[model samples]
Target: MSKHFWQTVGLGTIAGFRSMTAPALLTGNLAKFHPQALAGSPLRYLQKPLVATGFKLLAGGELVGDKLPQTPNRIAPPVLLGRLLSGALVGATLYKINHGKTLNGALLGSAVAGLATFGSFWLRKKTTDESGLPSALVGGLEDILVLSSGLALSKGTDIGAPAGRAL
Candidate 1:
């Protein structure tokens, strides 16, 4: 459908790999492109400052905690739910700001995030089993991918755009 719809879906897919990072990226986007959307919300007073700060901290913590031996699987019930919810919220916000169907966006986002979660988990396990590299290194790479993708999707920039046209 619309470019905004695709962008929201892309963000949701990224969120499946890194749940906390997606919301942080969305908060940044809301501050830059849709500040008015937050005006009447409960968080209006805290606004971007608090939202961005809190999510960023959470994202960073997630990345670090992910390397810990006691860390839970991303696909575990609690973690999966968080990722799904984050994807839905970000997708709805993006669609609402772009004047699209919020419910459709949320559904698309949640579905994609769930699929991505399973896909990434399988891929990560396969890679670790085959390559013999430390899981941490592979996970770090995934973190980078998720963060970059989140930023690009949230900014609504064409990833293949010419240098001058890229965000």
Candidate 2:
């Protein structure tokens, strides 16, 4: 497999946690760099402004709503389904950028999303319990992490490198 493949997987792993934000970041990138590719699709009408504004709003809403008491678990059926779809979309887009098969990306994205749903839930619970911080504070930090990850993936940064590897 190519470095791009690993990079895609890394981004998909992040997407498994961020779900909607990752895809929204991809949508923004597509709108900026390849507007014509979106043509004839349902999202074609979004254009740059709508794509940027709308997805950001949605992402913000998700972040805020997550801090609410009534917000559903990330692994809930409907929420998980949405996360899987978002991951697949973002992964497929990343694969297409590298001239790879979309199906492989979709499968990778969906699998990562499923795994991350459980993994992040456990990690978050553990962190909150250990740190003695409010869940909201931890969720805010997660929001920052997710947003940063999404942006890095969209920009195609050196995700292929291991932690200490030079880009």
Tens digits of lDDT, candidate 2, 25-104 = 66665565553433454444434667667877887788888899898888889888877877677666555555567688
So what's the TM-score on candidate 1? 0.84
Cα deviation of 148, candidate 1, in Å: 2.4
- Count clashes in each candidate, considering only residues at least 3 apart in sequence or on different chains: 0, 0
C-alpha RMSD of candidate 2:
5.5
Give each model a TM-score: 0.84, 0.79
User: Which pairs of residues clash in candidate 1, taking residues 3 or more apart in a chain or in different chains?
Assistant: none
Judged by lDDT against the true structure, how good is candidate 2?
Answer: 0.68
Model 2 lDDT at residue 90: 62
**How high is the lDDT of residue 110 in model 2?**
78
Candidate 1, 14-77: lDDT as tens digits:
8899888877777765555444444465433323667778988999999999888788898999
How high is the CA lDDT of each candidate model? 0.73, 0.68
